[model samples]
Target: MRKDVVPVSSPSPLPPLSPPAGPPPCPPARRVSLPAARPVRLVLCLSPVLLAGCWALADRPVASEGASRLAAADPGWLLAGAALTCLTWVAAACVRQGSLPDKLPPGLLLASQFAAGAANHVLPGGLGAHAVTLRFLRARGVPLDRATASIGLYSLARSVTRTLVLLAFLAACPARRRLGELVPDGPVPVPAAAVAGGALAVAGVLLTVVPPVRRPVTGLVRAALADARAVHGRPCRVLALWGGSAAMPLVQAGTLVCVGTSLGLGLPWEQVVLAHLAAGTAVGAVPAPGGLAVDAALVWTLVSFGAVPAVAAATVIGHRVLNDWLPLLPGALTLSALIRARAL
Candidate 1:
C-alpha cells in the first residue's frame, strides 16, 4: 500500500557560504604591553635634573659660597661676563663648522654647541660633548669617518691655537718673570713628554700589529688628511677654524677678567689673562673633567699674582658660575629637546 507520499522535496540546498564582506578581521590587534617604555621615558625626562642636582649637591659648600659671592658681585660686570660666555659657544660653533667641509644648519650647530657645554661638564675628557656631536653629525647624514676626522681636526686646531695664545701672552705679559717662578726646577716636563711619546709609540705598534685596528686607523688618517686639505682650501673655513679657536681662549680670559673685576679681586686684567692662560696650559694635560685641575691652578696663580685669597676664590667661583653653572640648566634643556626632536 503506497502511502500517499506527499512529494517531499529535498530541503533546498543551503546557499553556498559567501566570504565575509571584508578582509578577515585582523586578529584582535595584539595588545603589546611595553612595561619598560614609560619608565624609560621618565628616566630620560628626569636625567638632566638629576645630574644637575647631584653636581650641585656634591659641592654644596662651594656652590653656596659661589652663590653668595655672585649675589654680592657687580651685576653689570657679571652680565658682561655672561655675554662673553655666550660668545664662546658661538665661537665653538664656528670652529665646529669650519672643521667639516659640509655645511651644518647654523641654528642647530649653535644649539648643539650650547647643549654640548652642559654635557662637557658631566663627563671626563670631553667625552659627553664629543658623543653629542657625533650623534648630531650622524643624524645630519655625515659619514662616520668624516665626522670623526672633523672632531680630530677640531681638537688639534684648538690645542695649537691655545698653545700659540699662551706663548703670545707670555711674551707680552709684564708678569712673565712671576710666571717663570711657578715652573719647577726639575726634569718633570721631560718625563711627561717622554711618557706621552712612549704612549703614542706603543699605540702605533699595536695598530701595526693588528690588521683590523690598522685598517680603520689608516682609513681615518686618510680621511682626516683629505678633510683637512679640503677645509684649508677654503679661506672662510681657514679663518673660522683658526680664528675661532684663538678667540676661545681670549673670550674665556675676558670672562674671567670681568668676573674678577666685578668681585674686587686685586689684579690687572692683563695679569688675570696671563694667569688664566698659563694655568690652563699648565694643567690642560691633566685628565680631570670640567677643568677642575685648571680651576685649582688658576686659583693658585691668581694668589701668586697678589690677589687676596678670599677675593681670588670668589673671582674664580664667580667666573665658574658665569660660564659653567649658569648655562647648565638651559643647555641641558636644549639637549633634551634635541633628543626628543631626533636632531641630536
Candidate 2:
C-alpha cells in the first residue's frame, strides 16, 4: 500500500521548459552601406570648374591669347560653330544606338555621348569614351560580348564612312591637286601596309592553329557578325549608323568652316571643309589624344591653302575653344551625373 502511495505521488513537476531560442532576435537589420549621393553631386559640380581654372592658370599666356582672339572673332559665326559642334555629339549618339539592337534611353544616350567627348580627350585612341560606353551598356543589361561587338561595329562603320566621305570629297573638291601634294610620294606606305598585312596574317594563323585562342575568337567573330546582321536588317538602324557616320564628319567640317569664317581666314568654306576632312583622315591613325596631330595637320593644310598663318592659328584656336574647351566642363558634369544616377 505504502509503495503504491509512493509511486502514486505526483511525479516531480517537470522543470519549466526554457523558451525555445529564436533566431537571436534577428539583429537589427544592418543598414546597407551606400555612397552619399549629395556629397558626390557637390563634388561633381565643383571639380570641373576647379580643374578648368587650374588649366587656365597653368597655361595663362595661351589662355589669354585665346581669350583675346575669341573676343575679337565674329560672334555670329562662332555661335554657328558651337551649334555644329553640338550636332556632332548627336550624330555620335545615333551611331552608338544603331550599333545595338537593344533600345537605350534617348536622353541618356545623348548625355553619354556628350560625356564621351570629355573622356575621349583624356585617353589615347578613344579608350576613355569606349570605357564609359561599355560601362553604360553593361549597366543597361547588355551582354559584355554584344556590347563590345557594338563598339567594334560603330568604329568600323565610322571608319568606312569617313573613308567614303573623304573619297567623295576628294573627287568633288577643286583642291584635290593640292591635297594630293600633301601626300608624300614615297615607298613608306607600301612597307607600312605590308607590315600591317603580315601582322594580320600572323594573327589569323595563330587563331586558326591554337585551339584555346581559336574558340573564343571564333565565338566573338560569330557574335559580332550576328549583331551586325541584326543591326543592318533594320532600316532605322541602317540609317542611324550610316547617316550618323556621314553626318559627323560633315558637321565637324562645318564647324571648322564656321570658325575660319569668324576669324576672317582667306580660304573659301569649301576649301576649309576639304582641308579638315583631309587632315583628319590622314592623321586619324595616329594615337594622339584630342587630335593634337590632327590639329597640327589642319593648321598646316590651312596654311598651304593660302590662309594667313596668324588667321589660321587664330581660327584653329577658336575652333578648339568652341568644339573642345567649351564642352569639356559640361561633359564632365554630365558624366558625373550619370555615374551618380548609375546610368553608366
List candidate 2 stretches off by more than 4 Å.
Answer: 1-60, 209-212
Pairs in steric clash, model 1: none
TM-score for each of the candidates: 0.89, 0.86
Error of 2 at 301 (Å): 0.7
Write candidate 1's Cα lDDT for 188-226 as tens digits.
988989989999999989898989999999999999999
lDDT values, one for every candidate: 0.90, 0.85
Q: lDDT tens digits, residues 1-344, model 2?
A: 45544445677888999888886556678878567967777786556456655654665675567678989889998889889999999999999999998899999999999988877766768887899899899999998888999999999999999999888888888887887667787787999899999999999899979999998778778889999999999999999999999999999999999988888897888889889888988888789876778888998899888899988888887787789888877888788788778898
Which consecutive 10 residues in model 1 have the weakest lDDT in total? 41-50
Root-mean-square deviation per candidate: 6.3, 3.8
The collision pairs in model 2 are none
